[model samples]
Target: MARAHWHFPRTALAEHYLNVFDVGISSHLAFIAPRRKGKTAFILQDLAPAAQQQGYLCVYASLWGDPNAPHESIVQALEQAIDACASESKIKRMLSSKVRKAAISNEMLGRVEVEFANNPKSAGTRDLTRIDDLVTQLEKAAKDRTILLLIDEIQHLATSDDFSGLAHSLRTLLDRRQGRVKSIYTGSSRHYMHLLMSTQSSPFYHFANLHRFPDLGEDFCAFLQNKMASEYGVAVAMGSLVKAFGDLDHSPYWMQRLVERLVTEKCPLREAMNYTLELLDAAEGFEETAKTMKPVDRLVFLELADNGNPFSRALLSRIEAQTSNKGIPGTVQRALARLMEASLVSQIKKGEYHIEKPGLRRYLEKQVGSAPSR
Candidate 1:
């Protein structure tokens, strides 16, 4: 049998977010945090439930959920909400098998956002008028309850030029129903999220209040300690647990996996930590990624990870010295382009960037010295 879920509830935080929406401070909210940081869990387990209890008609979508039909993420959520208004049997029959496996209220875990939306190449073909009509229908079905839209990975819309039209349409769609529809968006890529919401030329500019999605802290560690001792009969020292969490970059996803390692393998915390790191490095493809990195790419990646200027003359000279290539602005530019294509780094602004795979840095630190591929 599967182990019972050990959720650390953030009911207070959920209420705080809901109250922000309730106060009409901003109908649109953009929350940014890295992946595996429990942002989605908080939304599904805490935020969405609280909203529903308070009479919210919650519709959640993950923009990248359907690899084949990504444009349909928002539409799909709306349709599922409509189906939810019908009889249980009818709803099951009308919706796909994915909807039935939901973990939270109407949150299609398979295509999750807790609710969220996405598209890259041609999600622009989405029908805006249909979206408007769907919202109207959901409003009627909601019986005057406010509609809360939980859109996940929303930064995907800003990653490609093709999604420009869709983004604009989505902005207009929300603008028209300012009071009726409230939205909370979560994005893992801080760079793209900034582009989507902060860039003046972007459709989403000033469209929402951007808030940093806080990471799981000591309380999360405490909760895990309680679960490990009570549920699995594994006694973990509080200091060790906190240190483990700190070592894993405070990622709840990996920390939970670490707990699983402790329970199943019946090993010490240090052994479990080592095992989890191996799993982490492998699961994130860090080893494979390292093999493909050119010396310049590695240098540029580390520079960006350190939040240092890749274009600085000093760093440019370092790259040239390390790779034996002419360390010029053009060279660094090319390296940056390659890193972006690798999906391991994000250029938040003209000359600014943030590391996408932080785990990769740790892997590289162990595998290769900072001096390029040398």
Candidate 2:
């Protein structure tokens, strides 16, 4: 089997945007990226580095809430982060001494504090009295400065109204303490974040610097390739790289999975290609793209996904040939408009429509035939 092309590996953010995240550049930065583009990785890699270096307390909370009670997710995450930062002996000592001093029973705190010796877990399991005390402790712990609150997939947090109220509460504390607390919000859902910020009526409007993670580029691909060669000894050739990129639908997470598969299976390039395509077919959104779309819409996307990445209207017309016997140009345009509105396709480079989602692209290509662009 032939050696397949492989792309350079680097964090998605390291691909485009460059900044140290210093003063005046709003401590609040909101990250938006396509799903599986390493949004969480960026949180761990890029943001965590700066926060740790600055000696800032970093609290990571998943915005995806529980169905039962979701209101205090961030608050809970912060508590956990604080607890985890404590040393094991320190936590044990604190629990024993604090409980003894307060005359509190072991049952009140529930689980042993030993489990929460990790940074985030420490505050996570605290009782109500402990929660009130934790806030005061954090205020003192910060040396009157702010703790960095990092929330991941923030769009999951209730709504802007509820989040705004939380932000307002945080703001009140920060204002009173004078720069003792800061926050960074991140989300993978671009449309949801846009909706939250588009209206000034929302509480979090203008709250953070909106930074978009761009597509993986040559540098990132190169880094990834070298890392594979050095660390995993997987010699991914240029051909495999191109093939992987073509099949990847351009998501970092899937790309990483591809790398892991290659290294683990020791599969030949041809086998890897087949495996990658299979993975794409089995991915989450592919079924819906193939099942839900109108035939014309599916054909339009298939052609775009295959040929132009961005295809011409003339090309779209050709793809929709089955329905064109009706001679309805306005109807055809509206169909494309609907696909775009549904985010099934996006304008790649003016006039040229491409399937916006990687899963959709693979599904469309696999189902309907795609006409090569002229």
Error of 2 at 114 (Å): 32
Specify the poorest-scoring 10-residue window by lDDT in model 1: 106-115
Give lDDT tens digits, candidate 1, residues 195-244. Answer: 88989999999998998988888998999888878878999999999999
TM-score of each: 0.84, 0.67
Model 2 clash tally, residue pairs: 28
In terms of TM-score, the best-performing candidate is 1
Residue-level lDDT tens digits of model 2 in 66-110: 312233555575565566555534433432342242223211322
Worst 10 residues of 2 by lDDT: 114-123
Which parts of model 2 have CA positions greater than 4 angstroms off?
1-21, 65-69, 85-137, 158-179, 227-233, 299-321, 324-356, 370-374
Q: Can you tell me which runs of candidate 1 are displaced by over 4 Å? A: 1-4, 86-126, 311-317, 327-330, 369-374
TM-score of 2: 0.67
**Residue 208 in model 2: lDDT:** 67
Q: Which residue pairs in model 1 clash with each other?
A: 60-115, 61-115, 61-116, 62-116, 63-117, 63-118, 115-150, 116-150, 116-151, 116-152
